[model samples]
Target: MSDPKTEEDIFAEVDAEIAAEEEAAAAEMDEPIGPSDSAVDGPGAGVDALVAERDELQDRLMRALAEAENIRKRGERDRREAEQYGGSKLARDMLPVFDNLRRALDAIDEPSRDVAGGVIEGVELTLRELLNVFGKHGIRPIAPEVGDVFDPQLHQAMFEAPVPNVPKGCIVQVMVEGFELHDRLLRPAQVGVSSTPAS
Candidate 1:
């Protein structure tokens, strides 16, 4: 009051107040006051918290997008498989009719083919049309010829026999033709194979 406080005294008083406030804060937090700790209380703290939240949200959004893409790709693959193989059962059932048609033609011997020429021609036409349809639909016949190497994957051995001049494991006769749908085997060709050659 007698003399206005000197600049030095004024600064000392302000510093004391700030130190007291810091002491109280440190006491409440159970830690020592430091420059770095003080910085965490200002406007910068809100910005840091907001930045952390933004990063977490961004991570979650990215993960969700990746999961959605994977689900879409899986669904597309399932749809394609269903489209390609949906008629497998129907195609399997129709094979018997094809076999019957083949039997009908084979029953007509060459000696009587001329006598029943018109009927035989009609049957032949039907067989040709059926085969054409089979080809168009990705169904192919596996008609292994005699002397072809026997393939266990594509042929079923009906029996094995020794044959002169024929290599072992070669086809001796094709008992029945097989069929395939796309890359899958609908039926394996039935065949007889040559046994091991005599020593």
Candidate 2:
């Protein structure tokens, strides 16, 4: 059989339970609150980390944009060059034909021209048309004449000779005219340079 509980015993038991709960709460309060020590260095550390990450990303973005701009510029330059001088090889091949036509005209004497006047007229017309087409395509002649100063950029010396009254480094004779495609030289004019010294 169980004995009945006294009022004083019950009160004492309740006081002990209350004390245990208070002790537990006090222990919790004494310990650190929020994140643990290993989780973060200090206040504002997380913000600094985020700012560094943002700066790195921004730098990468700028570099990417700059590279893209350079690629675009290079492509544009290539396209312009293609447009301006794409048929340079064909133009160069056709030069011999022009030379032949000019030779034909030059070889025709007055009597031969009188005998084949129609054929001569046709050749002249053909030559004129060929020149017109060349002009339209930005292909032009670099015609160096005698007495002009020899320029390595536009003239190729076929021979060097000492001539009277001609200054040194001057073009004594022109063998073949040069041609250019746009701003680029397709060929330099073949010339004879004088090696005469100034007296």
Candidate 3:
């Protein structure tokens, strides 16, 4: 209180305070900031994590695409099958009508045919038209001839007979013709098979 401070002393004290602040700031910058090891590896770790995430997302995308493709193919196959086999039941139900028509034709004798020529001709024309329609619709008859080799896939054995000069497993008689729609068998031919061995 007795001595008054001069301007120089005041200026020197201000300079000393600023110097101390600068020294403190410099010391803080020189020291390691945050965790030293983590700071060194942070960028690489971040890049690695991003790459792994990208790979995982890519894998998921590929699996989803593959599943979608499989579903599409399966749907296409189902549609094609539906289109090809849609009328199988109707085609099968009409077979008995065709068989009855054939039986009617077979039952007529020569005398009846001569007496009712016009009526017989009408029936024959109707039968032929029916066969033409069947041909148009991919329906074909499997008519197995007598003495042909019997095939279980296409023929149903109605009876077995032992006839002379007939080979075993050969067809001796055809009872009824089979029918097919496209590549599918609508009915198997009924036949009599020979049980006699070849001479």
Candidate 4:
């Protein structure tokens, strides 16, 4: 007893429903997915994270290597310094004995030298032996005498004296000798420097 619907009306309704469904599906796909979505997970995501981790680890490794190299260099410098200055105090104490030996040899008179030949020979031999010991331990003496140029780096002026024939600022007399170890001055020579004579 009911009348049949026209084909055009049925077709229009079905087409409208299909269009709405298609639009809704497109909006859902365009929306940004949050962490709740399982779409951006799996082996590909794990590979990317691993690549970032590897880069950070490589950077840390390079820094660690640089720090280690710096420590090694510092240790080497400390060791060299220790070796160079280890016996400085002992060497300084032995200098007075050498000075006494030199003074004893200087005090002997030329007239009495023949009578005390054995004593003079013993003293000379002892001085040579002491010098040999100094050479063995890298402790050498510097004996800059009068008429030498006054070197502030190796000599300490005790007084200035006017002396003829010697250039001004030259050494007039050496009061005490200097000493060096490995090119470094352990003690500066005590000296008298020359000045121009008064008119």
Candidate 5:
């Protein structure tokens, strides 16, 4: 019959196996625990990666902030423009009505106007009221007087005239008055500019 193993012997064998496992574990720890790549080479490897990531994130954040600011500024500009030029088209359309009224008043001579006093007074009153309304709404005529300096921005020359005493590039006559709404011009004045004398 085979002899049975002693308890002490079994315990010593178990202890030896435990010691071997500890040695193997120690060897594994001494070798290296993670991937043997450059990430574990030195402190600089991890630090560089972290710094690059931080810089990339910072750049992205700055770009996002700049884009947000640009959008806000664009919205503000559009709103201001809309408010400033809101009545431009309608104001422009009504200018012809004013022109016809002026034409009707001009067509009547003084004798005829005196003959029809009531009709003339009614038309004049209407013109005065219309002008008052135009003043209230910031609409004004750009009727330059004769001998005034010609402005290309405000005047459109209908014909050139060589006046005897008027300076060259000066207004010789205003054929049709212009109109403006606030600082913007609705139409440029039809004018006659003095010409330079021939050499």
Candidate 6:
């Protein structure tokens, strides 16, 4: 009563059954494994956690090294600054003594100059020794002489004096000698600037 199937039909049916069986087997194999089947947590998971911890520790170590380098650079800068300006207060205090020495030298006049020669020589020698000491410490005097052009940066004009021979704005007198430490002016020279003679 049933009709005989063709070869093509038989082959198609067999292929379909085979394909269905293969798909079912693949699905079974792809199913998620239970915790019991998984060996990850049983053996190598602790090693993976330790690796992660090592990476974090390495990051922290690099940050700490950078911070230490910054601190070292800051300390070096502070030390250099301290060395450069260490004697500022002492230099300021010694300025009055230099002024006194200059005043003593100026007090000796022509008539009394012969009588005060020995005292003046001693004072001059003391001043020269003091200046030598300053030179050793990188301090230099900046006293502008008469007929020198007035410079506002180095000279502070106390007053303007009329002098016939010198040009206007020229330095006529130095009231106090200035000083420099390295390239920076520690004090400006106190000076009397010359003006045109009164008409």
Question: Who wins the lDDT comparison?
Answer: 2
lDDT (Cα, tens digit) per residue for candidate 1, span 14-113: 5565556555644655655587866767634544554565567556756866797899999999998788777789888988888898989888898789
lDDT of 5 by residue, 1-199 (tens): 9786654565565556555655664555466546664355653444455456556755675686679789999999999878867888988888888888888888999899879989988888888898888888788989899989999999999999777877799998887889888899999998999998544
Model 6 Cα lDDT, one tens digit per residue, 1-199: 8886654565566556555655664565467867775554444454455456555755675686679789999999999877877887788788889999989888878877788788778999999999998888888999789889999999999999898867899998888999988777888999999888766
Which runs in model 1 stand beyond 4 Å of their true positions? Answer: 1-43
TM-score of each: 0.73, 0.75, 0.74, 0.73, 0.68, 0.64
RMSD of each: 17.2, 21.5, 22.2, 22.2, 20.0, 22.5
Model 3 spans with C-alpha error above 4 angstroms: 1-41, 197-199
Residue 141 shift from truth in candidate 4, angstroms: 1.7
Q: Assess candidate 2 and give its TM-score to the true structure.
A: 0.75
Look at candidate 5 and tell me the lDDT of residue 120.
83
Cα lDDT of model 4 overall?
Answer: 0.78
Candidates ranked by lDDT: 2, 1, 3, 6, 5, 4
List pairs with backbone clashes in candidate 6. none
Local error of candidate 2 at residue 16 (angstroms): 55
Computed on alpha carbons, the lDDT of every model, listed in order, comes to: 0.82, 0.83, 0.81, 0.78, 0.79, 0.80
- Give per-residue CA lDDT, model 2, range 1-199, as digits (tens): 8895654565465556555655665565566767774264554454455556556755675686679789999999999989999999999999998889988998999999989999999999999999999999999999988999999999999999888787799998888889999899988999999997546
Residue ranges of candidate 4 with Cα displaced over 4 Å: 1-35, 38-46
Q: How does model 6 score by TM-score? A: 0.64
Per-residue error (Å), model 5, residue 165:
3.8
lDDT of 6: 0.80
